[model samples]
Target: MTAYNKEEIIHQLESHQLWIDTLGKEGNKLGFDEVDFCNIDIDLIKYPLDQAYLTACTFDGMNLYGKDMHSSLICSSTFITTNLENADFYKADVSYVDFTNANVKNARYAKSDCSEAIFIKADLTNAKLISCSLYLTDFREATLKNVDVSSSSFKGVLLKGAKLSGIKGLEDAFIKSINIGTPEIPILIEGEEAVQWIINNCSTDEQI
Candidate 1:
C-alpha cells in the first residue's frame, strides 16, 4: 500500500487539475495505485477520477457532483453525507463502501462491483446500477425511487425501510435472497418470492 503526505497529494491534485485544464496535453493524468487515503483531506482532488486506485479512502461531506470515476478502484471507501449526484462510476470497484446519508441521485454505476456496500439513508433516486454485483449490500432506509438495477446480482441484500417506488429492472436482476422489514424481526425472502415481494410491496402506479 502506497502512502502520500498531504503536500504530495495536493501537488498531485494540482497536476491533475492542470491535466484537466489542458485536456491531457500538458500535465500527466493522476493515477494512484494501491494508495491508502484514510484521514487525508481529499477535497483538493479534482473531478473525473478516472482509472485511479482509491481503495479505502474516506470522503465525508465532499461535493463530488458530475465526476467521472469510471474504472476506478474505490473499494472499502467511506462517503458519508457526500454529494455524488450525476457522478459516473462505470465499471468501478466499489465493494464494501459506506455511503451513509449521501446524496447519490442520478449516479451511474453500470457494471460496478458494489458488493457488501452500505447505503443507509442514502438517496439514490434515478441512479443506474445495471449489471452490477450487489451481493450482501445493505440499502436500509435508502430512497431508491426510479433506480434501474437491471441484470444485477442481489443475493443477500438488505432492503429494510428502503423506498423502492418506481424502481426498474428488478425482474431482470438475479435475486437469490433479501432481508426486509425491521432489524429486530427481519423478514427474509428468497428466489422468485423475493422478486414478487419487492414488486408488490414497493411499487406504485407510477412505476417505470
Candidate 2:
C-alpha cells in the first residue's frame, strides 16, 4: 500500500471521471496503493460525495470504515477484502460488487440493492439490513451474527452454511431457494417445514 499526498490522490481521482461510467472503454481507475480519498480535508472540495458513479473501481484491502454512501450508484465495483465496518448504505445500489472477504460488521444497509454481490467468508457480524433488496446475493460461509433483516427480499440468495446465530427480523423476508444452516435460535419465517424444524429444536428446551 503505497502512500501519496493529498494533492496527488485528488488529481488521480479527478482524472478518472470521464471513464468512470464504463469500464474498458477509457482506462483503468483506482490503484493498488492506499489512497485516502475519504479522509482528505482540502479547500478544493466542499463536501463529500453524493450519487457518485464509481463503476469498476477496485478497492482491495482498503479501510472504508463508517462511510455514509446513501443513494449512491456503485455498480460493478469490486470491494475485495475491504473493511466496511459500520458503513451507512441507505438505498445504495451495489449490484455485482465483489465484497468477498470484507469486514462488514455492524453495517447498516437499509433499502439497499445488493443483488449478485459476493460476500464469501466475510465477517458480517451484527449487520442490520432493514427492508433491503438482496436478490441472488452470495453469502457462502459468512458470519451473520445478530443481523436484523426485517421486511427484506432475499429471492434466490445463497445462504448455505452461513453462521446465522442470533439473527433477527425475518417475519417478512422472502426465503425462496435460500439454504438455511442448522439454526441455533428460533427462525421467524413462514412454511410448515420451518415451523416444524423450530418446534423440534425447541422441544427439548424449556422456552418455545
Candidate 3:
C-alpha cells in the first residue's frame, strides 16, 4: 500500500486555486480546463470540489483506498489506472467520469448518479453499486466479477464485450440493449430475469 501525503496534496491543490478562481470564464478562455491529481489522497469532506465545475481532470496511478467522498459533485474526470479499492462514493454526482482500467474492488457507490460514465476495462470486482443511477453508462470490456448492482438503474447502459460473470442483483433492475457478449452476437437483454438468463447461458470471454 502507498502512503498518503496530506500536506503535499494540500499544497498542490492550493497552488491550483487560481485555476479554480477563474474556472468558469477566464479559465476556459485560457485553456485551463484540466487538473492533474496523480498519486494523492483526496479528502473531499474537508476540501471539497463539489462546485469546482472542473472538466477533463486526470487521476492516473493515484491511491484513493477507502476515501469517503459522499455527495461530491465531480464531473467528467478521468481516473485511468488508479487505485480506488474500498473507496466510498455514496450519492456523489459523478456523471460522465472515466474510470478506465482503475481498481475499484469493494468500492461503495450506493445511490450515486453515475450517468454516462465510462468504466471500460475497469476492475470492479466486489464493488457495491446499489440503487445507483447508471443511465447510459459504458462498461465495455470491463470486469464485473462479484459486482453488486442491486436496485441500480442501468437504463441504456453499454455492456458490450464486458465480463458479467459472478455479478449480483440483476433480479430487480431495469435494463435495455446491454450487450453481454461480442458484437457479432449482439446480445441485448431486457429486464432482470433476462439478464440472469444470459448470465447463466453465456460463456465469458477474456476479462478486462
Candidate 4:
C-alpha cells in the first residue's frame, strides 16, 4: 500500500538494474505492490521484472521485446500496441489486462491467469498458453497461428475473426460457450460443435 514518487521509483529501478547486471550481487530486486506506473516511461526500465507486483500499469506502445516478466502480478494493465514478442509471462496474474493490437508473437503465458483479458487484433502466433486460465477473454480478429493452448480453460472466450490455423491442444482445453461471430451478430457455440467449427474454419492451409 506504499505510494512512490517518480524519483523514488527511478532509484528502485536503477538498483534493480544493477542487481540484474551483477547477477543479484550488487543491488536489490524491484518488488512493489499496489503501485501505479502509468506516468513512467517503460522503455527506460530494465528487463526481468520477475515476481514484481505491477498491478494496473499502462504500457501502451512500448517495445518490451524478450522481457522476462514471469510470475509478476500485472492484472488490469494496458499494453495497447506494445511489442511483447518473446516476453515470458509464465504464471503471471494478467487478469483483465488489455493487449489490443499488441505484437505478442512467441510470448510464453504458461500457467498464467488471463481471465477477462482483451487481445483484440493482437498477433499471438506461436505463443505458448499451456495450462492457462482464459475464462471470458477476448481474442477478436487476433492471429493465433501455431499457438499451443494445452490444458487451458476457454470458457466464454471470444474468438471472432481469429486465425487459429496450426493451433494445438484444442481437445485438451476445457471450452464452454464461446463467441465465433461479431459482438453485434453474436454467434455462440459450445462443446464439440464449437471445437469442430474452429478446426474446420481455421485449420485450413489458406492464408488468413
Candidate 5:
C-alpha cells in the first residue's frame, strides 16, 4: 500500500476542491491507483487530480473537478490547462487524447471512446455525449453548447468553425463540413424531405 506520491498528489490537491471536496463524495475515489502506480505521468501543473487513472498522461495546469473517470484508459493523453468540470468519463478509453486548453464543462462522456481525439481550444460546454463514438475526432475551436450528440458516429470529423447549436442526434452525423462549406442550410424542423435526402445522396467527401 505504498504507491501514491507525486508529493501525495500535490498533498491531496491542497486539501479541498480536490475532485469535489474529496472524490466527489468518496464513492470510490482514487487518490492514487493508476493501475498500481508506476509513474503514469502525474504532474498536471504540480498535481491536484481526482479519481485519477491518467493512462499515458501529460496534463498541464490541472484541477480535474468532480472526477470519477470510470473504466479509465486515457490513451496517449495530453489535456493542457485542464480543469475537467463535472468529470465522469464513463466507459473511458479516450484514444489519442490531446484536449488542448481543456475545461470539459459538465463532462460525462457516457460510453466514451473518442478515437483520434484532439479538441483544440476545448470547453465542451454542458457536455454529456451519450452513446459516444466520435470517430476520427478533432473538434477545432470546440464549444458545443448544451451538447447531447446522441447515437454518435461522426466519421472523418473536423467541424470547422463548429457551432451546431443544441445538437440532437443530427440524423446520420458525418461532417467534414460536407466538403468545405456552402451546402449546410437545412433547418426546416419537419425533416424537409429528410433534409433533401441528405442534400441529394450524402458523402460529399471532406477528405480521405
Candidate 6:
C-alpha cells in the first residue's frame, strides 16, 4: 500500500471538493460519488467522514479512532491491521472490504451492509452490528467478545476458528445460512440455542 502524507490528502480533497467532502458537508454541496483512495494510509480520526464514497482504497495500518461514517459507501476497501476502535459505521455499505487483523473494538456497524467482508483474526471486541447484512462475510479466527449481531443477516457467514466468547444477540440473529464447515452443529437454531452453541462448542472446539 502507498503511504499517503497530509499534503496528498489535502490535495485530493481540494481537487475533488466537488466530488469529495473531506468533512461532513452542508446542504446544496456536492461530494464525489466515490473517492479513489487506493493503497493510501490516511488518518481520518480527526474528521467526520459521513456519506463518503470510497471504494477500492487501501487503509492498511491506519488509525481511525472514533470516526463517524454514517450512511457512507466504502465497498472493496482494505483495512488490514488498521485501528478502528470506537468507529461508527452506521448504515454504511462496506461490501467486499478486508479488515483482517484490524482493531475494531467498540465499533458500531448497525444496519450496515457488510456482505463478503473479511475479518480474519480481527479484534472486534464489544462491537455492535445490530440488524446488519453479513452475507458471505468471513470472520474466521477473529476475536468477537461481547459483539452484538442481533437480528442481523448471516447467510453463508464463516465462523470457523472464530473466538466468540460472551457474544450477544446470536440467539436473535439469523444463522440458518451459516457455513460452519461441519454438520455436527445444528443447521437451524433459535437465539438462545445459538448462544449456547457458541459458548459450549465454539469455545472448546477447533472449528477450522
Worst 10 residues of 5 by lDDT: 174-183
Candidate 6 clashing pairs, residues 3+ apart or interchain: 19-31, 19-32, 20-32, 171-191
Error of 2 at 61 (Å): 0.3
Enumerate clash totals for all models, in the order shown. Answer: 0, 0, 0, 0, 0, 4
Model 5 scores a TM of: 0.29
| Regions of model 4 farther than 4 Å from truth | 1-6, 15-45, 182-186, 203-208
User: Between prediction 3 and prediction 6, which has the larger lDDT?
Assistant: 6
Instruction: Name the runs in model 6 displaced over 4 angstroms.
Output: 1-8, 11-42, 182-196, 202-208
Task: List candidate 2 segments past 4 Å from native.
Answer: 1-47, 180-208
TM-score of structure candidate 1: 0.82
lDDT winner? 4
Candidate 4 per-residue lDDT over residues 28-72, each given as its tens digit: 877775555556654443545776777777678888898888988
* Residue 76 displacement in candidate 2 (angstroms): 1.2
Which stretches of candidate 5 lie above 4 Å from their native place?
A: 1-6, 10-19, 22-36, 39-67, 70-75, 78-87, 90-95, 98-153, 157-172, 175-208
Per-model TM-score versus the true fold: 0.82, 0.67, 0.70, 0.84, 0.29, 0.76
What tens-digit string does per-residue lDDT give for candidate 6 at 25-99? 422221333343434444455444666666767667777877777788888888899888998999999899999
In terms of lDDT, the poorest run of 10 residues in model 4 is 38-47
- Candidate 5: C-alpha RMSD to true structure equals 12.4
* True-structure RMSD, every candidate: 4.1, 8.4, 7.4, 3.5, 12.4, 4.9
Sort by lDDT, best first: 4, 1, 6, 3, 2, 5
lDDT of 3 by residue, 1-208 (tens): 2233667556545544454566644322111146565644565334434334446667677776776666666677788888889888888877989999999989888999999888989988889999999887888877887888888887667777677777778776665546555435555666765576547743555543
For residues 101-175, write the lDDT of model 2, one tens digit per residue: 999999988888988888887888888888888777778778777788888877656665566566677666655
Using TM-score, rank the candidates from best to worst: 4, 1, 6, 3, 2, 5
